[model samples]
Target: MIALERPDDPEAFFEHAAALLAEGIAPEHVSWSGGESADLFAAATRAPRAKWRGEKLFAAALLHRAENRFSLVYRALWRAARAKGWLGNPADPDLCALRKLEGEVRRDSHKMRALVRFREIRDAEGERFIAWYEPSHFTLRANADFFAHRFANMRWSIVTPDLSAHYDGEVRFAPGGSRRDVPAEDARDEDWRTYYAAIFNPARLNLAAMQSHLPKKFWRNLPEARVIPTLARAAQNRAEAMIAAPPTAPRFSRASAPQTEAAATDLADLRAQLACCEKCPLHREATQVVCGAGPLNAQLMIVAEQPGDHEDLAGSPLIGPAGKIFDEALRRTGCDREKIYVTNAVKHFKFTLKGKRRIHAKPGAGEIDACSSWLHREIEIVRPKVIVAMGATALRGLTGQILAVRESRGKMFDLAEDRRLLTTTHPAYLLRLQDEQEKRLAWRAFLSDLAQAHAMAQA
Candidate 1:
């Protein structure tokens, strides 16, 4: 057995693991600190350097958190060097554990950035800001540059249990200390509290969600910690007052909202009526009305749940990440997208604002019912021989009944006017999966559904 000194940090572990690999030491035969003593290759290494194929950053982050990181990383390095495509395999037990470590490290880093509160202090350097944080992992150094770039004009120092990072014009790391090292408060905290109160929206109060993001562990460090309870308690009253005083701007709907349905003769005319649809309240918040795109006389009609962020802005359906997945599936199945018509169940994009980003909100039952007319008209105009409903939302829109997509996928149901409806998993569903094997299985199932639909359309 080869005895090696254990690496303490991520960088040291990376270097040691690489050197061990270069010396051609098998992972099982090498011992970092303690292991059973009986190996065939007894001493100095003779094997040539195995070429590394795996990402170093991937191993580095996990090494900082895992309990048996030395063994785990060395085994990963050994397989990654000799075996082709070993790095891409998520089915490996070590890779699965590494992924979990990556998530925890990522969350810890985000919390370090968000919850670290700095207090102004005076010393020989005039005035400087100092903050103390206790992270779950060794994330203090990783997030140091974020603070440096965000508050470049000010001199700040962050001290954690493991290490300390200081930034004047350049960043420097030092030894860490306890929470008592940082001061309690600064005059700027009052300003922070005032700004938090000004932007607090009482109407959208979700206490559970707030607690999930700003957990109990971070409450003591926050300037607005005491004010959160006060604001939450008075949210109902404040929301009522805001509703009564909201004459600043009338919702910008057309003076004469279109009297949807029966006025449309063709696809173009139906789209014109759909533009000013006020039948649903979702129209009030959306950017613009998105409608179907493709040939009017196509034999196959594809229906998705609704427009995403990109589709909302561009006024076209399936034009973002979901679109790329769908395009690839079409290519695999030998189906031409241009020959098929595509549209959504709901014309408007429904989302909630997070900072400046609009997160996609699932359409409720009432919203789906309101938009059913536009889809009804679309079906009448196009009159495709076969309709493929991607996901349960599209399925519900067609039948007006809630049915599980998984239970009914790849099965054909006869519809009115000599048309057929086929159920399938959405391209968006495939995007949510993290495991490589699961993604591959889901892709195959999705492709099979599309291929079946295409064949039925041709027949």
Candidate 2:
């Protein structure tokens, strides 16, 4: 075995690994030398290195706290050089192990960044800040630039057992020192403790979550950590006190009645309210509230999912490409588009932008729920004999239960007060089917469902 002494740093390891690869040294034949023993083989020849420093995973794996990391990383690199695209195969055991090590190094770096507590210290030259931190991994050097960016104008020094970093206008590194070298107490510490206590909100206190973010291991250096236990003990009483506190008067008055009472009282009032509705985020970008357009007392009510891009701009439902398909289906089924009430489950068009064109995005459950009030108001006002619900969103709004279109189609279910609802495929679904045969079949099914709804309305 060509035993070699491994250095305790990434850049050094990079150079060492590159030399081994150049000399054509097999990974298994190499053993790490430490203490008294050393390599007696000819010096490793220089070769073109694998771009390990430029690769984030390789760089982070080198910083892992494990003792065997040096050999493991060397082995991985050796295999990667021989086997094409081995590093990219995440399913490989070696890559998985390497990823775990990288995660540990990153987590350690994050902890060091979060828990480092600085204290004000004045030397003969000027005011500066010093922090003493104990990180499990060799991450002080890796995280030094973070502090530089966060506190660019200030002079600061972070001293760990393995390394130390200092920054004024520029960053510099020095040899590590003991925690005893750092001053434990500072004048600003008391003020920090006061601030920590003042900002602690009892109402939002989550002990498990707090412990997860602020581990007990870091409490030794944090000034506010001393009071954490006391605050936790008193949290229940404090929260109760907050809950029992006298109700404050409204800072700004809204129309006193609830949305259900006010908005649902009349269809005209609901439409006016919906135009300015901020109930969900969908309204923020939508052109206008595309309310239902049809005769007031139409026998059949047709509810589509929501407005499409064209319908959004034109301020009408079922006027886009999907609308054209629906019109074709209506013509085939002998159903008059003007005689029936046509609206959407949601009033606004929800979409994501792809280049200049807007791609339709399915509305989430929260958005659907928020818009249900308007739908309910529409139903109350129109009071149609039969409702044809196109797509899952429409079915959900009318029935308040998720029903599959394929399973529920061609059948009518009672929807209270002698009214009925028929679930069917949306015209947009027909438009998405690329196969001409499948499109033909789906359109026939849709027309059949619409014809059934029309027949039910007449009955």
Q: Which one is best on TM-score?
A: 2
lDDT of 1 by residue, 322-427 (tens): 9999999999899999999999998899999999999999999888878877786788789898999998888777767788888788888876647888889989
Q: RMSD per prediction, one decimal?
A: 15.3, 11.5
TM-scores across all candidates?
0.49, 0.54
Candidate 2: stretches off by over 4 Å: 1-8, 31-57, 88-91, 198-213, 239-250, 253-312, 315-352, 355-459
lDDT of 2 by residue, 1-459 (tens): 333333235765676577677778887766553222444663543333453343433778777667567678888988887898887798998888888998888888888887788988888879999999988777887788889999998999999877789998888988888788788888777877888889888889998898777677778888778777888788889999988986331121123212364755666776788888888999899999899989888999999999999999999899999999999888988899989999999889999999999999998888887887788778778889999899999877776666677767767776675678788999999889999999889888888899999998988
Q: What is the lDDT of residue 157 in candidate 1?
A: 93
Flag clash pairs in model 1.
none
lDDT of 2 at 437: 96
